[model samples]
Target: MDRSKQLYEQDATDWQRGMYEDIKTTFRAPIVNWYFRSLTANEPAFTRYLWGQLKPLFQTRAFGRYAVSYRDTVLSAIEDGPADLPRYRRADTALRPAEWRELRGQLATFDVVAPRLALTFAVCDRAMHGDLPDANPEGAPSTAPLPPWLDRDRGQSVTMLEAGDVPGDLSETVDEIRAFHGLEEGLPSIYRCLAQWPGYLEPAWTDLEPILESEAFERGCRDADAVVDGHLEELPYTPRLSPNDLAEQGFDDETIDDIQHYVRAFNRGAVSKVLQTIVTYAATLDAGGERSL
Candidate 1:
């Protein structure tokens, strides 16, 4: 982690609280992603510029339609053993029906949109390079209910547990999640949620490594990214801001561009990383969330 960038959640600023809430609501996720967090940690205004362009596009009904369609396609497109998903899911009991529904919906949203997010980042990156992404995104999905589990009161993501913070038996699972995923930032937040159920976490660690390492999973992710690429038109984007625009706001071009490129790259690949993680976790929930913590 760069000292200049706030890579961890503890480094968040006050403004980020509001942004995190809004972004979570918009994205239907349990927490804000590290990519967005690091960007804001470095420069708060970047959130406005970066997400402003992206937010509108994502908010559209059309984008939602494509997202839903793409998710369905990718889920089936992969050859990763669906046969194994049943087994991985067999060991759970924490969440009730609505909770299970909430968890899987949130996980699926990330999984289904994984490829498009990668493309969107590429589009943003090209704009920085003076190649614009198309402002036109089409399609409409009816307004759907978001997962109630993301609610701060009734349901919250269990605070992410550090390896040392976990019970001795569960520590290795955290290590493998980091080692196998090759994440520079250790485990993503969702894994900690699994830590609450040791039985689920134990088997889940075994299930994920092979599936993520498989040819079918890689092919599915690539195909999903391409599908979104085909559906999109690359239009010119100019940093979503300029030297003057940033300077007037008490920032500089170099920092803004640096943040843009860094975050764009972060976002580009984040979908698959998150998808690989969440779906593996969701298998248990999908199998009906049967075990108690």
Candidate 2:
């Protein structure tokens, strides 16, 4: 399989695709997370090896409950940071009920999934890098079930747009996103996924572009990581996927470290930023501001 085409979910195996959908259904997300996409770029062998062992952990009924709770703690990490971002509502459009529903679903999906995935990537990054997380944090976060309002819409799945599928018209926007990341690591999945809803993209970029270039926003990411990291500290992370395990599985130091690069980049660079943006977007919508666009 070509490395370029591998970024899309459509090219994966049936079982691999099923696993991807299972994750989406569990998290109520409309898209394949970049973590899995990056992992499966090579015929799903490494991904299958890693996730097969980890699936049982997610299958535990308690895991979903814990994930929802953990998400809240992650959001709290930087919920109050300065966006310094002007709201860019759709200027020429009024959302129909259906559009509103989809928009709401999209926002809600990220609200939960972003943070949960953030913690997951964090654990995997540390594990692969030989940084053992504490079995329990100094103050572990609660694992309470989500409240009725928070748990309401589980969100319908949508067609995920790949990098190559981005419209020619949006090339400039994609360029801006690349510039925002400042590391040439590849555009964030949030941008590509949200581009499916251009109306939302208008506002999302409006808010994110400025903040992504600023000093305070970086600090906010660190702030959020502190909170999420504190909670994740308590994860009883398995050593099966650690550096030692990868080494035993025939991966050399460089190979193991390469995996860590993807994990760590997605964990620190994309996941938390996407979470904060989604949280802020949800807050704006819920406030019932000017309705049009």
Candidate 3:
């Protein structure tokens, strides 16, 4: 346990140092500040609005990357979990193994999204500086390969939506589905309150015409289809289940509601932690009298 504590402290110190360096370098740019302002907009309401606009851009691949990154950091800390000894010693020693495991799982989930929150902050900083990346040109060739980090199908989904090939209502439905899958945080309450929203499978075959009409959109569809097909074709032949099917599999209404509430609360806490970390690191850089941009 003492060894674990030492390792935890060591890692925490390293993380703090890396954060300081990041603030002094990449985060010091005027673009980052601009981006922050755009996303956060000084008002809580605006923050929600910005999230509504951006949430659809998050897809399964992106979510998977977030989850994996978060899981790795969290699991490492768990091996060092008992390292909170100084504080533990000062408090009750009533910790149980199950509780510890549960707490660790929560931390892992939190870690998964922390870097994404950091990236969002960076994007906001850039927007504030009027340095937003140019919107991809209309009718541009869609054949350009995606970044290795991106989920291929998810990227294709974004390409289709942005091209306006999908009906606006259908696109919004897709966004809602992504949000339900734990992709990102801050979905508007209005979206949540709506009932009987169109499911992805319900989209009419006729409605696909617009998507197929644009060459760029068609390319995206092909790419996304390839990804979906590959997943379907892969080992141990399990059938794909729809969202409704998953929802129906035995949880009581109260339990489902509780789960939703918890997910929202977790997202709020994670966002708060990320913001606090960024601000603290930025302050350290400022104290050193470093000019960022």
Q: In order, how many clashes per candidate?
A: 12, 1, 19
Comparing candidate 2 with candidate 3, which one achieves the higher lDDT? 2
Full ranking by TM-score: 2, 1, 3
- lDDT of candidate 3 vs native? 0.29
Tens-digit lDDT string for candidate 1 (128-170): 5554544542322223332333212323333446644677787
User: Worst 10-residue stretch by lDDT in candidate 2?
Assistant: 284-293
Q: Candidate 3's residue-wise lDDT over 233-289, tens digit each?
A: 221212111123224554345533433333234333333233222221112112111
Candidates 2 and 3 compared by TM-score, better number = 2
Model 2 residue 230 lDDT score: 62
Per-candidate RMSD, Å: 6.4, 5.6, 25.4
> What is candidate 2's lDDT per residue for 70-155, written digit by digit as tens?
44432343344454444434343366667766766666556556655766677777777777564552222233333334333455
Those runs of model 2 whose alpha carbons end farther than 4 Å from true positions after fitting are 1-14, 53-93, 137-153, 160-175, 183-186, 207-219, 250-257, 268-272, 287-293
Top model number, lDDT? 2
